[model samples]
Target chain A: MELLANLALGLETAVTPTNLLFCFAGVFLGTFVGVIPGVGPLAAISMLFPITFYLDPTAALIMLAGIYYGTTYGGSTASILLNIPGATSSAVTCLDGHPMAKQGRAGVALFMTTIASFVGGSFGIIILSLFSPLIAEYALTFGPAEYFALMVLGLIAASTISNASPSKGLAMVVFGMLFATVGTDSQSGVGRFTFGSMSLLEGFGISAMAMGLFGVGEILSSVGATRIAKIDSSSAKLLNMLPSKDDWRRSWLPGLRGSSIGSFIGALPGTGPSIAVFMAYAFEKRVSKTPERFGHGAIEGVVAPETANNAADQTAFIPTLTLGIPGSATMALMLGALMIHGIQPGPTLIVEQPSLFWGLVMSFWIGNLLLLILNLPLIGLWVRLLLIPYHYLYPAILVFLCIGAYSVRANPADVLIILGFGFVGYAMRLADLPAAPLLLGFVLGPLVETQFRRAMVLARGDFTDVVTRPIAGTVLALAAAILVWTLVSAIMRYRRGMKALTRNPTG
Target chain B: MLDRDYRDIVAGLGLTAIGAAAALYALFNYNLGTFTRMGPGMMPVSLGIILAVFGLLIAFPALSRSGDLPPLKIRPMIVMSISIFSFALMIESVGLVPAVFFTTVIATFSETRVPLVSALVLGAGMTLLTWSLFILGLGLPISSFDWPF
Candidate 1:
C-alpha cells in the first residue's frame, strides 16, 4: 500500500511539465551520444553537470537517470548497425549484432534490441524499487566500520572486474587514490599533494577528469584515423523492423535469462554492465541447442546481450542509491553529480528524500517508453548520423568539453586540467590501462579514508574490530577473499603463460 | 622504440617513481598521527607505500608477453592539446566566441585540413551553440563577445 502511494506520488512528479521536458531532453541526448562512435554519455553527462547546478535537484536527478539507461539502449544501435560499440559495455553486442547486420538483418536486430532493452530495463527497475527500501532499512544500522569494510569490498571488486591484468588494475586504483588526495585534507585542512596550486585545493573536478579521459582522450586517439560505416540500406526499412513470429518465439526466454544475469551483476557494488553483457552472452551460447549458430546472426545472440546491458544499466543504481556505493564507473560519476548538488546519497536518501528517489524511478519508465517511440522510426536518421565525419564531430565535442569544464567553477583553469588529463588518459590508453577503475578510485578513495579514520577513532585504534564486528567483519572477510582470489589467479595465469612460452619455442 | 615485452616493467618503474615521491613527500611534510587518531597524512602515506610496492610487483617479471605499444598519433594530439590550451587562455581573456572560433579552427587541422570558409562556418556554429547552451539556457555568467584587448 505504501509502495503504491509512493509510486503514485512519483507518477505525479514525473508527469509535470518541467520534469517531462528534461527527461525527454536527457534521453534524447543520451541516445544521440550512444549512436555516435568515439563520443560517450559520460562526457555528455559531465557536460550537463554544470547545467544541473541550476535546475531543481529532483529534475536534475531525473534527467541524469534518463541519460544513464538511455545510453545503454543507444549503445547497442552502433553495435548492431556499424559493428562498433558506442561504449565499452556494448562490446558483446557486436559479436552477433554485426553478424546480423552483415546478413542483412540489421532492422530485425535493431528492433529486437529495443524490445529486449525495454524488458530488461523494466525488470531492473522493478527489482530496484522492491529491494532499495529494504536495503536502506538495513543500511541505516551501519556504523563507520561497516562502511569502510563495504568500501574495501567495492574497491577490490572494481579493480578485479576490468578485463586487463588484475595487477595493472590494482595499480590504477592506487594511482587514482593518489590523484584523489590532491585536494586539501578535510579533517586537518592541510594539502596532501596540491603542489601549491589554488585550483588543486578543491581537488580534481570529476567533470574535468571524466571529459578529459573519456571524451578528449577518445578524440585524440581516433580523430586521425578514418573509418566508414557500411549500412544495409534495404534492410533498414520500417517493414524489416517487425521481427518474424519465429524470432519473437526465440527471444522472450533469452531476454528473461539475460535480464536476470544483468540485474544480479549490476547490483554488485563494483561489477558493471560490461561484465554483465559478456556473462549473458556466454550463458546464452552455453545453453543453446545449436551452439554453432551463436555468433552467426542468431536472433538470440542479439537479444540476450542487449537485454543484459540494459538490465545492468538500470540495476546499477541499486548500490549507488541505497548504499552510497557506486556499482560502476558511470554510477560513481552520477554520485559525484548528486554530491555536487548537495544531495547526499545513501540509506537516509530514500527515507529523507522520497520524492527525489521515487520520482526519478518513475521518469526512467517514461524515458524507456520515449526511446521505443524514438528508436525504430529514427533508425534511418541515426544511420545518417554515423556518416558525419569524426573530424567534423570532434571539433564540436571539443568546444562543449571546454565549456563544460569552465562552467564547473566558472574558472578557465578546469579546462587546462582536462587538457592535462587528456594527455594522461591518452597515455593510459596507449599503455592498455583501464580508465574506468581510475574513475572509481578517484571517487571512492576519500570516502574509504574518512570511514577508516572514523572507525579507528571509535575503536580507540584497535584494528581488530574490523574483523571482530559481525557485519563489518563479514564484509571485510569478503574483501580479503576477493583480494586473495584475484592475486592467486593472476599468479596462476602468469605461470601458465610462462609454461606456454617455454613449451613453444619458435624455429 | 622501447621493447614491447618490457612495457609492464617500464610502467611499473614509472609508478614506483611516482609512488615513492608521494610517499617521501607525505613522510616529511605532515603529522603522522597514531592509528586511533589518524592525521591527514595517514591515508596518503599508507597509499603511497602500497602504490610503490604494487609498482615493484608489476615491474618484477621474466618478460615473455608480446604486445607492442601503438605509435602515438603525435600530430593530432599535439594540435588538439594546443587548441585546448589556447581555448583555456582565450575563454577568460577574449570571450566565448573568439575562444571557440580560434580553437575550432586549430582543432580541425588535427585530422585533415579543412578549407578556411568551412572552418569559419563550423567555428561560428559552435560559438553560437556554446553561447546559447551555457549563457542562454543554463544561465552561466559570461560575455558572448567581449574584446580581451
Candidate 2:
C-alpha cells in the first residue's frame, strides 16, 4: 500500500508537462551523443550542466537521470550499427553486435536490445524502489566509523577495477585525493594548496573537471585514430524489427540473469556497468550450450550485455541515493548536482524530501518508456545520424565544452582548469593509467576525510577502537583483503614472467 | 626489449614529485595534531605519503625491463591544447564570438579540415548557435563583443 502511494506521488510529479518535456529532451540528446563514437553521456551531461542550473532541481535531476539510461541504449546502437562502441561498457556488445549486423540482423539486434533494455531497466527500478528505502532505513544506524570504512572499501574497489594493475590505479586515486585537497580545508578554514590564487579557493569545479577529463580528453585520444566501419541502412526495414521465435526463446532467460547480475554489481560501491556487462558475458559464455557459437553473431551475447549494462546503470543509483556513497563516477556527478541544489543525499533525504526521490523514480519509468518508443521507429534515423563527420562534430563539442566550463561560475579560470585536466587526462591515458578511479577518488576524498576525523573523535584518539567495532572492522578487512589479493596476483604475474624470460634467455 | 615497460617509471616519477611537493607543503605549513584532535593537514599528508609509495611501486618494476614506446602525436596534442587555451584566454576579455571563431579555426587542424570557405561558414554557424544557446537561451552574463580591450 505504501509502495503504491509513493508511486502515485511519483506519477503525479512526473506527469507534469515540465518533467515530461525535460525527460524527452534528455533521452533524445543522450541517444544522439551516445551514437557518436568518441562523445559520451559524461560529455553530454557536462555540456548540458550549465543549462540545468536554470531549472528546478527536480526537473534537473529527472533530465540527468534520463540522459544516463538513454546513453546506455544509444551506446548499443553505435555498437550494432557501426561496430564502434561509444563507451567501454558497450565494448562487449560489439563482439556479437557487429557480427550480427554483418549477418544482416541489425534490425533484429536493435529490437531485442530495446526490449531487453526496457526489461532490464524496469527490473532495476523495481528493485531500487523496493530496496533503497530499506537500505536507507538500515543505513541510518551507521556511525562515522562505518561510513569511513565503507568509503575505504569503495575507493580501493574502484581503484583496483580501473586498470590491469592495482598500483597504477592507486597512484591515480592518490593523485586525485591530493588534487581534492587543493582548496581551503573546511575543518581548519586554512588553505593548504591554493598557492594564493583567488580562483583556487573552491578547489576544482566538478563539472569542469568532468568535461575536461572525459569530454576533451576523449577528443584528444580519438583524433589520431580514424574509424572505418560501414552500416547498411537498407537492412533496418520495419519488417526486420521483429525477433524470431528462436531468438525470443534464447533471449528472455539471459536477460533475467543479466539483470540480476547487473543489479547486484551496481548496488556495490565502486563497481558499475562495465564490470557487470563483462561478468554477464563471461557467465553466459560459461553456461551456454555450445560455447563455440558465443562470439560469432550469437543473439545471447548481444542480449546479455545490453541487459546488464542498462540494469546496472539504474541500480548504481541505489548506493548514491540511499547512503550518499556513489557507485560510479557518473553517480558521483549526480551527487555533486544534488549538493548544488542544497539537497543532501544521505539517509535523511528520503524522509526530508520524499517528493524529490519518488518523483525522480517515476521520471525514470516514463523516460525508459520514451526511450523504447524512440529507439524502435527511429532506428533508421539514428543510422542516418552516423553520417555526421568528426570534423563537423568536434568543433561544436569544443564550443559547448568551453561554454559549460565557463558558465560554472562564469569564471574564466574554470576553462583554464578544464584545459589543464584535459592534458592531464590525455597524459594518463598515454601512460596506461585508469582515469575512472581518479574521478571517484576526487568525489570521495573530502567525505572520507571528515568521516575519518569524526570517527577518531568518537574513539577518543584510540585507533584500536576502529578495529574493535564489528561493522567497520569487517568493511576495512574486506578492503585490506582486496588490496592484499591484488598485490599477491601482481607479484605472481611478475615471477611467472621472470621465469619465462629466464627459460628463453636467447629469445 | 623486455616484457615490462618504462612508461610506468616516468608516470611514477611525475607522481612522486607531486606527492613530495604536497607532503612537504603540508608538513611545513600546517599543524599535525594528535589523533584525538586531528588537524586538516592530516589527510593530505597521509595521502601524499601513500602516493609516493604507490609511485615507487609503479616505477620500480619498469626500471628493469624495456618496453616499446609508441611515437606520441605531438601535433594534435599541441593543436587541441592551444585552441582550448586560446578560448580560455579570450572568453572573458575579448568575448564569446571571437573566442569561438578562433578556437574553431585552430581545433580544425587536428583532423582533416573542410575547405576554407566551408570552415568560415561552420565557424559563423557555431558563433550564431552559441550566441543563441549561451546568450539567448541560458542568459550567461557575457557579451557578443567585449571589444574595448
Candidate 3:
C-alpha cells in the first residue's frame, strides 16, 4: 500500500508537462546520437549537460536518465543495419544482428530486440523500485570504514574486471585520482597541486573532462575509420517488422534469462551494460540446442544481449542513487550532475528528496515507451540519418563539444583543459588503456579520500582495527579475492599462449 | 630487432614518470600528517606509489614478450587539437560567432575531402545556430559578437 501510494506520487510528478517534454527531448536526442556510429550516450549526455543547469532539478535528472536508457534502445539499430555498434554496449549485438541483416531478417531482428529490450528494462525497473529504498535503508547502518572498504572494492573491481590489462586500468585509475587531488583540500585548506593558479583552485570541470575524453577524443579516433554498410530500406517498413512464430517461441525464455542476469550484474558496483550484454550473449550461446547457428542470424543471440543491455542500463542506477557509488563512467557523470545541482546522493537522498527520486524513476518507464513508439515507425528515418557524411557530422559534434565545455563555467580555461585532455585521451586510446576506470576514479577519488580519513580517525589510526569490523572485513576480503582471481587468470592465459606458440613453431 | 612489447613499455614508463613526479612534489610541498588527523598529501603520495608499482608490474613482464603497437593517426589528433585550441582562444576574448565559425572551418578541413564551399557554409551555419541556440534561446551570458578593440 505504501509502495502504491509512493508510486502514485511519482506518476503525478512525472506527468507534469515540463518534465514530460524534457523526457521526450532527451530520448529523441539520445536516439539521434545512438543511431550514429562512434557516438555513445556518454558523449551525448555530456554535450547536453550544460543546458540542464537552467532546468528544475527533477526535470534535469529525468531527462538525463532518459538519455541514458534511450541510447540502449536506439543503439541496436546501427548494429543490425550497418554491423557498426552505435554504442560500446551494443558491440556484442553486431555478431548476430548484422548476420540477420544479411539474411533479410533485419526487420525481425529489430522488432524482437525492441520487445526483448522492453521486457528487460521493465524487469530492471521493477527491481530498482523495490530494492532501492531497502538498499538505502540498509546502507544507512554503514560506518565510514564500511564505506571506505566498499569504495576500495569498487575502484579495484573497475580496474581489474575490464577488457584492458589490469595494470593499465589501475594506472588510469591512479592517474585520475592524482588529478582529483589538484584543488585546495577541503579538510586541511591547503592547496596541493594548484601551482599557484586561481583556476586550479577548483580543479578540473567535470563537463570539460567528460566532453574531451568521450566526445572530442572519440571523434579523433574515429575520424578516418568510420564505415557504414548499406541498410535495406524495405526491411525497415512496418509490414516487414513482424517476427515469425518460431522466432517468437525461441526468444521469450532467453529474454527472461537475460533480464535476470542483467539485473543482478547491473545492481553490483563496478559493472554495467557492456559486460552484461557480453555475458548474456555467451550464456545464450552455451544454452542453445544448435550452437552452430549461434552467430549466424540466431534470433536468440540478438534478443538476449539486447534485453540484457537495456535491463542493465535501468539497474545501473542502483548503486549511484542508493549508495552514491557509481558503477560505471556514465553513472559517475550522473552523480556529478547531481552534485552540480547541490543534491548529495546517498542513503538520505530518498527520504529528503522523494519527489526527485521517484519522478526520475517513473520517467524511465515513460522514456522506454517513447523509445518503442519512436523506433518502430521511425526506423526508416534513423537509417537515412546514417547517410549523413562523417565530414559533416564530425564538425558539428566538435563545435557542440567546445561550446558545451565553455558553457560549463563560461571559462576559456576550461576549454583549454578539454583540449589537453583530448590529446591525453587520444594517447590513452593509442596505448590500449581503458578510460572508463579513470573517469570513475576521478569522480569518486575525493569521496574515497574523505571516507578513508574518517575511518582512520574513528579507529584511532589503527588500520587493522578498521579492517576487523565485520562489514568492512567482508568487503575488503571480497576485493582481495577478486585480485587473486585476476592474477591467477592472467597467469593461466599467459601459459596457454606460451603452449600454443611452442606447438605451432612458426618459421 | 628486440621482440618486446613497446606499447606496454612506453605506457608503463610514462605512468612511472607521472606518478613519481606527483609523489615527489606532494612530499616536498604538502604536510603528511598522522593517520588520525590526516593531511592533504597522504592520499596523493600513497596513490602515486601504487601507480608506480602498477606501472612496473605492467612493464616487467612485457620485457620478455612480443606485442603489436596500436596504429597512431597523428593527423586527426593534431588537426582537432589545433581547432579546439583556436576555439578556446577566441570564445572568450573575441566572441562566440567568430569562435564557432573559425572552429567549424578548421575542424571540417581535418577530413581533407571537404570542399572549400561547404566548409565555409558549415561555418556560417554553425555560427548562426550557436548564436541562436545558446544566446537567444537559452539566455546564457555569452555575447554573440564581442569585437575586442
Candidate 4:
C-alpha cells in the first residue's frame, strides 16, 4: 500500500508536461549518441551540463538519468547491426548479435535486445524502489568511521577488481587523491599547490575536467582510428522484427536470470553495467545445453547480456543516491552534476527531497517506454546516422565541448583545463592505464579524507579506536583482505610468467 | 625506439617523479600536524608516498616483460589543443560567434580529408546552432557578438 502511494506520488511528479518533454528529449539525444560508435554517454552528459544550468534540478536530473539508462537500450543497435559497439558495455553484444545479423536475423536481434532491455530495466526499477529506502534507513546509523572504512573498501575494490594490474590502478587512485589536494584546504584555510595562480585556488572544475577527460579525450583517441563500416539497412525490415515462438521461449528464462544477476551486481559498489553484462554472458554460456551456439547466433546470447546491461545501468544508482557514494565513474559524474546544483546527496536526500528522488525514479520507466517506441520505428533512421562522415561530425562535437566547458563558469580558462586533461587522458590511454579509477579517486578522495579526519578527531587520534568499531572494523578488514589477495595474486601471476619463459626460450 | 618495451618503465618513472615532486613540495611548504589535528599537507604527503611506492611496484616486475610503447598521434593532439586554446582566447573578447567559427575552422585541419570550404560551412552552421540553442533557447548570459576595446 505504501509502495503504491509512493509510486502514485512519483507518477504525479513525473507526468508534468515539462518533465515529460525533457525526458523524451534526454532519451532522444541518448539514442543519437549511443548509435554512434565513438561517443559514450559520459561525454554526452558532460556536454549537456551547460544546458542543465538553466533548468530546475528535478528536470535536469530527470533528463540526465533518462540519458543514462537510454544509452544501454541504443548501444546494442550498433553492436547488432555494424559489429561496432556503441558503448563499452555493449561490446559483448557484438559477439553473437553480429552473427545474428549475418544470418538475416538482424531484425529479430534488434527487437529482442529492446525487449530484454525493457525487462531488465523494469526489474531494476522495482529493486531500486524497494531497496533504496531501506538502504538509506540503515545508512542513517553510519558514523564518520564507518563511512571512511566503507569508502576505503569501495576504492580498493574499484582499483583491484577492475584493472588487470592492481598496482597501476592503485597508482592512478593515489595520483587522483594527490590532485584533489591542490586547492585551498577548507579545514585549515591554507592554500596548497596553488603556485599563486588564481584558478588553482578553487582547484579544477568537475565539469571542465570531465569534458576534457571524457569528451575531448575520447575524440582525441578515436578521431583518427575509427572507420565506420557500411551497414546494410535492408536486413532490418519492419516485418522481419517479430520473433518466432521459439525465440520467445528461449528469451524469457535468460531475461529473468539476467535481471536478477544485473540487479545484484549493480547494487554492489565498484561494479557497473560492463561487468554485469560480462558476468551474465559467461553464466549463460556455461549453463547452455549446447555451449557451441554461443559465439554463433545464439538468441540467448543477445537476450541475457542485453538484459543484464540495462538492469545494471538502472541499479548502479542504488549506492549513488542512497549512500552518497558512487559505485562507478559514471555515477560519480552524476553526483558531480547534482553537486553543481547545490544539492548535497546523503541519507537525508530522499527524506528531504522526496519529490526529486521519486520523480527521477519514475522518469526511468517513462524513459524506457519512450525508448521502445522510438527505437522500433526509428531503426532505419539510426542506421542512416551511422553513415555521416567522421570529419564533419568531430568538428561539430569539438565546438560543443569548448562551449560547454566555457559555459560552466563563463570562464574561458576552463576550456584550457579540458585541453590539459585531454592530453593527460590521451597519455593514460597510450600507457594502457584505466581512467575510471582516476576519476573515482578524484571524486571520492576528499570525501574519504574528511570522514577519516572526523573519525580520528572523535577517536582522539587513536587509529585503532576508529578501526575497532564493529562496522568500520568489518569494512576495513574487507579492504585489507582485498589488498593482500591482489598482491598475492599478482606475485603468483608473475612467477607463472617467469616459469613459462624458462620452459620455452624461443619456442 | 628501443628493442625492448620501455612503456612500463617510462610510465612508472613518470608517476614516481610526479609523486616525489608533490611529496617534497608538501613537506617543504606546509606543516605536518599530529593525527587528530591533521594539517592540509598530511594527506598529500601520504598519498604521494603511496603513489611513488605503487609506481616502483609497477616498474620492477615490468623489467622482465617485453612490449613496445604505443604510438602517440601528434597531429590530432596539436590541432585539438590549438583550436581549443584559440576558442578560450577569443570567446571573452569577441564572443561566441567568432570563437565557434575560429575553433571549428582550425579543428577541421585535424583531419586531412576535409576540404577548406566544408570547414567554413561547418563553422557557420555551428555558430548559428550554438547561438540559437544556448543564447536564444536556453537564455544563457553570454552575448552572441561582442567587441572589447
Candidate 5:
C-alpha cells in the first residue's frame, strides 16, 4: 500500500512536462545510439553525463535511465535485422534472431523482444522498488575483506563464464588490473607504473577505456571482416507482429525464469546484463524439453535472453543507487553522473533526496512504458535503419566515439588514450580474449585495491583478519571455492583434450 | 634453429623478458620502508610477477607444441597497427571531425569496394551527422568546421 502511494508521488514528479520531455529524448537518443555497432549504453550514457549536470536531478536521472532501458531494447533490432549485435548483451539474440530474420520472421522477433524486454524491465523495477533499501542496508555491513572477496568471486565467475579459455580471461583480468595501477597511488601518493609521464597521474578514464575497447575495437574488427548486410525484403504485415499462440506458450516460462535468474545475478556487483543474458540463454537451453530448437529460429531462444538482459539492466541499478557501488559499467556511468550533480548515491540518498529517488524509480516505469509505445510504432523505422550503408554508419560512430572521449575531462590526452586502447582492444579480440572482464577489472580494480589497503591498515597488517571477520570470511570462502572449481574444470578439460588427441594419433 | 612453434615461442619469451625487467625495475625503485605502510609498488610488482608467470606459461606451451604453424596475417596486422598510430597522430592536429572522417575512410580500404564514390559519400555523410549531434548539440569541442557550408 505504501509502495503504491510512494509510486503515485513518483509519477507526479516524473510526468511533469520537463521530466517527460527528457524521458522521451533519452529513449529516442538511446535507440539511435543502441542501433549502432560498437557503441553500447555505457558510451551513450557517459557521453550524456556532462549534459545531465545542469538539468534537475530527477529529470537527469529519468533521461539516463531511459537511455539505459531503451538501449537494451534497441540492441535486439540490429541483432535480428542485420546479424550484428549492437551491444554485447544482444550477442545471444543474434543466434536465433538473425535466423528468424532470414526466415522472414524479423517482425515477430522484433515484437517479441520488445514485449519480453518490457515485461522483464517492469519486473525488475518492481523488485528494485521493493528490495533496494533492504539490500543496501545489508550491504552496508560488508567490510573491506568482504568487498575484496566479492570482487575475486566476480572475476572468477566472469572468467569461467566467458566464451574463451579461462587462462585467457584470467590474463585479461590481470592485464586490466595492471592497467589500473598506472596512475598515482591513492594511499601513498606515489606513482607506480606511470614511468614519470604526467598523464598517468589521473589514471586511465573508464569512458576512454570503454570507448576504445568496445567502440574502436569494433570498428577495427568490422574493417577487417567482410559483412554484407542482410535486409528482409518481405513486407511484414501488422498482423504478423504478435507472437503465435504456440509461440507465446513456449516463451512465457522462459521469460519468467529469465526474469528470476537475471534479477538475482544483477544485484551482485561487477556483473551486468551481458552475463545475465548469457546465463539465461544457457539455462533455457539446459531446461528445455527440446534443446536443439535453440539455434534454429526458436522464439524461446529470442525471448529468454532478451527478457533477462533487460531485467538485469534495470535491477543492476539497485546497487548503484542504494549502495554507491555500481554493478556494471552503465551503472557506473550513472553513478558518475550523480556525483557530478553533487548527489552521492548511497544509504542516505533516499532520505536526503526522496523526490529524486522516488522520481527516478517512477520514471523507470514510465520510461519502460514510453519505450514500449515508442518502439512498437517505430519498429518499421528501426528495421529501415538496417538499410543504411555500413560505410556511412562507421564514420559517424567514430566521430561520436571521439566526441564522447573528449567530453570526459575535455582533455585531448583522453582522446589519444581512447585510440590507443582501441588498438589494444582489437589485439585482445584477435587473441580471442573476452573484453568484459577487462572492463570489470578496470572499473572495480581501484575500488578493490583501496578497500584491500584500508582493511590491512585497519587490521594492523594482520592478514588473518581477511578471513577472521565473519561476513568477509564467508565471501572469501566463496571466492576460494570458485577459484578451486575453475582450476579443477580447466585441468579436467585439458586432460580430456589430451586423451582425445592421443586416441586419434594421426589417423 | 627455428621450430614450427618459433613465432609463438619468440613472442611469449619476449613478453616474459619484458615483464621480468619491468618487475625488477619497479622493485628497485620502490621505497620498501614506505611500502611497509602499503605503497604504490606493491600492486604493480605483484601484477608484473603474475604477468611474467603467464608469459612463461605461454612460452612453455609454445615450446612443447609440434604442428604446422599458422602464418600470421601480416598485412591486416600492419594495416591495423598503422591505422591506430595514424589516429593518435591525426586526432589533435586535424581535430575530431576530419580526423575521424579520414581515418574511417582509410580503414574501409581493408574491404573490397565496387564504387569509390559511394564509399566517399558514405564517409562524408557519417562525419556530418556525428559533428552535428556530438559537437554542435553536445558541445564536445571536436571541430573547427574548416569546410565552408
Candidate 6:
C-alpha cells in the first residue's frame, strides 16, 4: 500500500509540465550523443552536470537518468548500421549486428534491438522500483568497516572483470589510488602529492580525466582509421524490417535471461553494462543450439547483449542512488552532480526526498517508452547520424570535452590533466590493458581509503574490525573468494597453454 | 605479437623504478609513521614497494626472452598526442565555439580529404548548437571569443 501511494506521488511529480519537458530533452540529447561515435553517455552526463545546478533536483536527476539509459538504446544504432560501436557496451553488437546489416537485415536488427531494449529496460525499472528501498535500508546498517569491505569487493570485482591481464588491472588500480592521493589529505591538513600547486589541492577532477581518456583518446585512435562508411539504403524500408516469428521466439528468452543477469550484476557496486553484456554474450554462446552462428548475424546474439546492456545500464543506478557508491563511471558523474546539488544520497534520501527518488524511478519507465518510440519510427534518422564524416564529428566532440573539463572547476590545469590521461589511456589501449578498470580504480580509490581510515579511527586503530564484523566479514570473504578463483583460473589457463606449446614443439 | 611475458617484465621493472623514486621523494619530504598508525607517506610508500615487486616479476621474463616485439606505430601516437594537447591549449583563448570549430577542422584535414567549407560549416553549426543548449538554455556561462575586447 505504501509503495503504491509513493508511486502515485511519484507519478504526480514526474507528470508535471516542467519535469516532462526535461525528460524529453534528456532522452533526445542522449540519443544524439549515443549516435555519435566518439562521445559516450559518461562524457555527455559529465558535460551536462554543471548545467543542471540551477534546475529543480527532481527535474535535473530525471533528465540525467534519461541520458544514461537512452544512450544504451542509441549506442546500438552505430554498431548495427556501421561496424563502429558508439559506446563500449555496444562492442559486442558489432559482431552480429554488422553481419545482419551486411545481409540486408539492418532494419530488422534496429527494430529488434529497440524491442529488446524496451523489454530489458522495463524489467530493470521494475527491479529498481521493487528493490531499491530494501537495499537502501540495508545499506544504512553499514559502518565504516562495512563500507571499506564493500569497496574492496567492488575493486576486486572490477579488476577481475576487466578484459585484460589481471596484473595490468591491479597495476592500474594501484596507480589510480595513487592519483586519488594527489590532493589534500582529508584526515590531516597537509598536502601530500600537490607539490605546492594550488590546482592540485582539489585533486584531479573526474570530468577532466573521463573527457581526456574517452573523448580525446577516441579522436586520437580515429586519426588513421578508415573513414566512416555510408550504407546503401536504396532497398531499406521500415515496413519489411519487423522480426520474424523465429526471431521473436529466440529473442524473448534471451531478453528475459539477460535482464535477470544484468539486474543482478548491476546491483553490485562497480559492475556495469560492459560486464553484463560480456557475461550475457558468454552465457548465450554456451546455451545456443548452434553457437557458431553467434558471430555471424544470429538474431539471438543481437538480442541478448543488447537486452542485458540496457538492463544493466538502468539498474546500475540502484547502488548509486541508495548507497552513494557509484556502480559505474556514469554513475560516478551522477554522484558528482548530486553532490553539487547538495543532495547527499543514502538511506536518509528516501525519507528526506521521497519525491526525488520515486520521481526519478518513474521517469525511467517513461524515458524507456520515449526511447522505443523515438528509435523505431526514427531508426532511419539515427542511421543517418552515422553519415556525418569523422573529420567533422571528432573535432566537435573534442570541443565539448574541453569545455566540459574546464567547466568542472573552471581551471585550465584540469584540461591538461585530461590530456595527460588521454595519452596514458592511449598507451594502455595499445598495451591491451582495459580502460574500464582504470576508471573503476580512479572512482573507487578514494572511497576505499577514506572508509579504511574511518574504520581504524572508530576501532581505535584495530584493523580486525574489517573481518570481525559479520556483514563486513562476509563481504570480505566473498571478495577473497573471487580473487582466489580468478587467480586459480588464470594459472590453470596458463599451464594449459604451456602444456600445449610443449606438446606441439616437434609435432 | 608482443610477448605477454616480455611486456610484463618491462612494465614491472618500469613500475618498480617509478615506485622507488616516489617512495624516496616522499620519505625525504614527509614522515612515515608506524604501521599501526599510517602517516601520509605510508600508503604511497607501501604501494610503491608492491609496484616495485610486480615490476621485478615482469622484468624476470623479459630478461629470459631473446626475441623483440614489433615497434608500435608512432604516427597515430604522435597525431593523437598533439591533438589532445591542442584541444587543451585552445579551449579558453579561442572560446569553446571557435576553439572546437577550428580544432575539428584541423583534425579532419589531418587524415581524410574533407572539403574545407563543409568541415567549417559542420564545426560552426555544432559549436553553435552546443553553445545554445548548454550555455544559453542551460545557463552554463560559456563565453564567446567573437566579442570585441
Candidate 2 collision pairs: none
Model 2 misplaced regions, further than 4 Å: B1-4, B145-149
Better of 2 and 3 by DockQ: 3
Tens digit per residue, CA lDDT, model 6, A276-352: 88899889989999999998999988988888987887788888788777766677677767776778887778878
lDDT of residue A168 for candidate 4: 91
Question: Local distance difference test, per candidate?
Answer: 0.83, 0.84, 0.85, 0.85, 0.73, 0.74
* Backbone-clash count (model 5): 0
Candidate number with greatest lDDT: 4
Ranking of predictions according to TM-score: 4, 1, 2, 3, 6, 5
After aligning candidate 2 to the native by TM-score, how far in Å is the CA of A371 from where it should be?
A: 1.0
Q: Chain B TM per candidate, please?
A: 0.86, 0.83, 0.90, 0.94, 0.69, 0.74
TM-score of each: 0.97, 0.96, 0.96, 0.97, 0.87, 0.90
Name the TM-score of candidate 2: 0.96
Per-residue CA lDDT of model 5 for B2-82, tens digit only, reads 333455455456556756776787788865433226777677677678777766655555443344443444444455445
Which is the winner by DockQ between candidate 1 and candidate 4? Answer: 4
Best by DockQ: 4
Select the stronger candidate by TM-score from 1 and 6: 1
Q: Score the docking of each candidate (DockQ).
A: 0.67, 0.63, 0.66, 0.71, 0.35, 0.41
Per-residue lDDT of model 2, residues A1-507, tens digit only: 999999999889998998889899888877877777666666666666666776789898888877877777888888888888777788899988888888899999988989989988998899899998999999999999999999889888888874678998888878887889889888888887888887787888788888888888878877757666577887777788798999999999999999999888888877888899999999999999978888888999989988888888889988899999986777888888888777788898888889889998889888899999888988888888887777777877887888788877888878878888888888888888877778878889999988999999999999889978999999999999999998998788777766766787643
For every candidate, give the share of true A-B contacts it also has. 0.74, 0.66, 0.72, 0.75, 0.34, 0.34
Better by DockQ, candidate 5 or 2? 2
TM-score of chain A of 5: 0.90
Query: Per the 3 Å backbone cut-off, how many clashing residue pairs does candidate 6 have?
Result: 3
In candidate 6, stretches whose alpha carbon ends up further than 4 angstroms from where it belongs are A38-56, A86-88, A228-230, A234-236, A282-293, A492-507, B1-7, B34-37, B55-97, B146-149
